[model samples]
Target: MGVVSATARSDRYPKQDRSRATRQKLLEAAVACLAEHGWTGSTVTVVAERAGVSRGAAQHHFPTREDLFTAAVEYVAEQRSSALRELPAQDRRSVVAALVDLYTGPLFRAALHLWVAASHEEQLHARVTELEARVGRETHRIAVELLRADESVPGVRETVQGFLDMARGLGLANVLTDDRARRERVVEQWAGLLDGALGD
Candidate 1:
């Protein structure tokens, strides 16, 4: 490979830039279809339509429903990570705060709904479970890495996870409930968990 050709290729593609736009479109479509019809009922054709792309294009990009779902899951995870990129290394509470916003936020609801619906699809259950576990393990890994959970800090993952669980469970409860105050109250409880988790 000549330097000129290599440089030209890099200039045009930049490695990370290639396929990102298409991937984003496909993921958005996947989420849309999943939310509209649930994972079991969401067909690749519907997703293609949602993305305003050819069925062949969708298939070329994803290859299979599982592939698309996994990509969508990963995309969501990446989006979450991007939001917290500026966070300082010393702050574990920032991770917790991001976790709260993630569980209770708008995009997360689509993921949560798609995931729950995915669980009921027999053909996709194992695949969905794998994706869900991947996301969970990432959260745990972040807690471990940032919080430095070791024998001395025995329960870092457990403590962070349990705190998140309460926020998540209550957040879910506010989804259909019309009372805005309830949701705000539940979200504010994170302030308490933040203090406890950060030893402040």
Candidate 2:
């Protein structure tokens, strides 16, 4: 090949980068729409508009509404999982508090909308079930690593699982009413209990 100009090389990669950027934008917009307005409001057209992209482009990336939303759910989960991996070092109490905040925040709200909608939509139910399982496993992995807790010990695994289940229940409660004070109280108590049982 003849001398490849710098401009040509740069131009070649931008098309792919732009495509990825657009897809990411759509995913993020979908999450925001779901959290703010629920699944009924998160139409592909609405998500595209929120992302500042054309409906055609959104459809090109995600041919079906299910495809778009399922991808969006996975996208948010993966983003949160990645962030969890990079969390700065903190004491057990701080980590537990942070984890509680995460479970009750925007990402959890977005997922709540999807879960409720999925219960009524047969096609969506299957995808959300699978996605939720995968995200759950990843979250568990991150928690275990962060805590360095020995799951092999008797009751340790059950306790951790129970804590996560409790957090999720609290998160669901937070959607309909103000459960912040109760959540804080429970989280602090749980943190202390966990430290007593598992701390170095």
Candidate 3:
């Protein structure tokens, strides 16, 4: 009985690992497709092909297009949050730059696509709205931590939120053109403003 039990456990692990790996691949591929092609172009079949998994396998994991994309965005958001948490103590300027970089990445691009689609798609609206709210709260909390801001200090919370909003605006601008030079100037100016607004 013990030997049979051990054999069964060993057999299960490989299958479980493969399933996890497949799901991860699908999520990543979905994000890439969304970022590169936007919502109208990113379909389940396309994502499955990009992931190098069969459509049947992708469907088994996600069941629907909405499920795949929402999960993909959520998964990448968690990963970005983890990366943010892992940053070592840095100067406020560095922290500001790091936060801004978050909005300029592939994850943000993919999430923006999802947001645009959700605006017109009833089936996706509620799920995307909830996900964005959760992600927004987490990002704000992380920004506060990274900036060492005391929200107890009046205006500090709003200041942090304003910075995030500005970063998002910069991201939107970059979608049309390479705004690197202008963004650098803006980042420097914002870091100085943040230092004053969220003082030591």
* Best candidate (score: lDDT): 3
User: What stretches of model 1 exceed 4 Å from their correct place?
Assistant: 1-19, 88-96, 143-151, 178-180, 197-200
User: Residue-wise lDDT of candidate 1 within 1-200, one digit each (tens)?
Assistant: 99999898888885457466766888987876665566667778888888888899789888988788767766877777665554567655555555566665555666676677676767667877887788777766665555444524556556767765776776577566643576556556765565576463
Looking at candidate 1, what is the lDDT of residue 124?
Answer: 65
Residue ranges of candidate 3 with Cα displaced over 4 Å:
none
lDDT by residue (tens digit), candidate 3, 58-175: 9999999999999999999999999999999999999999999999888999999999999999999999999999999999999999999999998998999999999999998888
Order the candidates by lDDT, highest first: 3, 2, 1
Weakest 10 consecutive residues of candidate 2 by summed lDDT: 1-10
- What is residue 194's positional error in candidate 3, in angstroms? 0.6
User: Which lDDT tens digits does candidate 2 get at residues 1-200?
Assistant: 44577778788899999999999999999888989999988899999999999999999999998899889888988987788789888788887777677678778999999989999999899999999999888877777777777888888777777777877888998998889988888898999898888757
Better of 2 and 3 by TM-score: 3
TM-score of model 3 (CA atoms): 0.98
Q: Write down the worst ten-residue block by lDDT for model 1.
A: 143-152
User: TM-score for all predictions?
Assistant: 0.75, 0.92, 0.98
